[model samples]
Target: MKIMIMRHGEAEATALSDGQRPLTEEGINEVTQVAELVAEEYVVSKIIASPLLRAQQTASLMATGLNLPAVDTLTELAPEHKPESVLKALASEEAEVLLLVSHMPLVDQLAGWLLEGSRMSPIAFPTATVAVLHTDHLAAGVAELERVFLAPS
Candidate 1:
């Protein structure tokens, strides 16, 4: 299976809470463009995102771009959580290509854990960045970092 880990699009700086922040217009456009790229190059079966507003919006954009019908929200994908729990939850996913949208630190950490089995995250994910990983068995250090698509400039 292939896991497409993505960081949410750019968001407003102020909100009642961080989770309430919505995507900026630029962010929406950029994510829409990137989603087009993804649709052109890959086959995505499922989209999972953090429950936060920006992430949810990003997932909705991605779902629209990919011609998908649903986006599943996982609380474990929130910024405050660690990668292990999300990874564990995703272990049972049978999709050929599964997409996950979340925030930094968690996105970085999850990519790091999947790539090297450590706490250090190597890639710097700009807003709406997507990292594709391939693995037969869902476990740390067993997945290969296939490629990464950066956010628009």
Candidate 2:
């Protein structure tokens, strides 16, 4: 299975509420570019995102580029969610190619859990970045980073 983990694009700092923060104009453009790149480079079967506006917006762009529906927002994929739960959800999902759009610590933690069984320091996603993980089995705890895509600033 191939999992594409993406961090949401840049968003305004002052939001109505933290979770409701929308992407900035720069963020929109950056994510759009990355989405187009993904569309040309990969075959994504499913897109999943956190309920936060920034993540939803980012996922929406990628979904459109891939000709897939908008991601199903799941609280379990939100920031602060337990890593084990995220892993469980991924394991249970039937999709062979999955795209996940989420926040920083969660994205970083998820990557670590899938790769090394521990939390990792956040790797700045820089507006629109996608990290691809290739694994022999989705349910098994073994995967390797295939590549990382960083949108040009």
Candidate 3:
């Protein structure tokens, strides 16, 4: 199985209204370009995204490029959620190729936990970066980081 973890695109610092944050034009363009890049190289089967607007929007763009359905929002992968739960949830899912769009520390921590069974500090997942992991199984600590694709900011 191949799991691709993507950080959300650039977003405004504050929302116009409560819970109304959306991606800026540049963010949308950046994510779209990143999605095209992913499509050119990978065969994505399923997409999962955080509930946040930026993450969801990024996932949607990727899904569109892949001709797949819109992402299924996984609350466990939300920005404020714990990394353990996200890993647990991922371990339970059955997909050959899974794409996840989420926040920074969470994405970095998840990758570190999968790769080393522990968290690595100073997580630095720039906007629209995708980290790919390969594994025979989805259990915790089973994955190996294959590569990281960084989209131009």
Candidate 3 residue runs with Cα over 4 Å from true position: 16-19, 121-123
How do all models score by TM-score?
0.97, 0.92, 0.90
- Residue-wise C-alpha lDDT for candidate 3, range 110-145, written one tens digit per residue: 877777667672335888888888988655576888
Candidate 1 positional error at 46, Å: 0.1
lDDT agreement of model 2 with the native: 0.83
Task: Give the backbone clash total of model 2.
Answer: 0
Model 1 clashes, total count:
0
- lDDT for each residue of candidate 2 in 34-147, tens digit (9 for 90 to 100): 988888889999999999999999999889888996578778788889767887776677787899999878888877777776677234466678989888765324778887
Q: Give, for candidate 3, the lowest lDDT window spanning 10 residues.
A: 115-124
Q: Write candidate 1's Cα lDDT for 1-153 as tens digits.
A: 999999999999999999999999999988999999899899899999999999999999999999999999999999999989988888678999999999988999999888888757677899999999998877788789888888668
Best by lDDT: 1
Cα shift from native, residue 113, model 1 (Å): 0.4
Which one wins on TM-score? 1
Q: Which is the winner by TM-score between candidate 1 and candidate 2?
A: 1
